[model samples]
Target: MTDEPRRRGAARTDELLRVTLETAAEVGYAGLNVEAVARRAGVGKHTIYRRWPTMAALLLDALSRVWTTDLDYHDTGDIRADLREQFLRSAPALAAPPIGPVYRAVIAEAQADEALRATLHDRFLRTVEESTLARIKRAQEAGELVSGVDLTFPAEVLCGTLYYRHLLSTRAVDETAVDALLDMFMAAYGT
Candidate 1:
């Protein structure tokens, strides 16, 4: 509750997230357990268990926290440009070193764990969909984009393709690819 305790809590949470990322990347999804993360993070087993109720929950948090990409933005008045900017900035984070492996492992784990998959969809993918849909609707109302454009398509294409490439492609997801993907999506629906 106090400042010092809060600070320590925040720092410890950060450490736990980092250790999970490293451990997940190194040992992979099935191999990742809280005890190892606790030992690596130099925290007690209770620290992780207290914060996250389950192993799937902890890994989901680690993936969400450690492999972060804050795609938030103030509307720039041009919907296409805003979307492009978001992709350009956040796409690179996907291809970055430790985050990529952490992401891959979380996704892999999610495949086997129904609960983890649902949590990830709720936490990450749903938020993205809602945000993009809202922005696209705003753009439509503002006359920045054409009406009746189903916002879902663009959001799905942008995020889905990025993940598709990240998980499958031998080539890295880069700035140019992000720009191209945005362009392709925009061209389909933009006024």
Candidate 2:
């Protein structure tokens, strides 16, 4: 009997997350609200409020569910190739709908909201940066990169440049751009 309620709750949570993504895709972050989600989800406002304290929190959870790409690099022995592969795989998703637009919206809102900014960093940016740093560190240990250097800045630059181009510039994060970025990184850090 208890299992039935738990299963239903899980299903409802999934439905809510789906509706949240759909709503965000249609109306964007500025147009999104708890009431809107509740209406679209066919649930009372209290239901959503019980799960998430705020719209940003709900959006964050929704984004997390959809953006489930491993973000971890494959140890293909070649650092440049590994980085390139990861970037090429992820760049398209970042440039497309659902994940892309929703993420951009959160980022825009984060600019004005300190708490959201911190939450966004804690939930998303930090994960990407850490994964990137771990990959770079592995390469350095293998002597593919320069020795005894702090890779944190380079990792941020790599990830941040792509994000900046995607969110702030006109450039597409295409294969050519990825190759160019890899070339630059290799030249600067390669042993």
Off by over 4 Å in 1: 1-8
TM-score of 1: 0.84
Q: What are the TM-scores, per candidate, against the unseen true structure?
A: 0.84, 0.94
Q: Count the backbone clashes (under 3 Å) in each candidate.
A: 0, 0
Which residue runs does candidate 2 get wrong by more than 4 Å?
Answer: 1-7
Local error of candidate 2 at residue 81 (angstroms) = 0.4
Error of 1 at 146 (Å): 2.2
lDDT tens readout by residue for model 1, 55-164: 77877777677545776755989887787777667766777757777777778778988988899889888887777778777888998766876777777766788788
Worst 10 residues of 1 by lDDT: 1-10
lDDT of 1: 0.77
lDDT of 1 at 116: 82
Q: Summarize candidate 2's per-residue lDDT along 1-191 as a digit string, tens digits.
A: 34444334878999899999999999999999999998987779999999999999999999998886879799998999999999989998888878999999989999999999999999999999999999999999999999989999999999999999889888999999999999999999999
Q: What is the lDDT of residue 61 in candidate 1?
A: 76
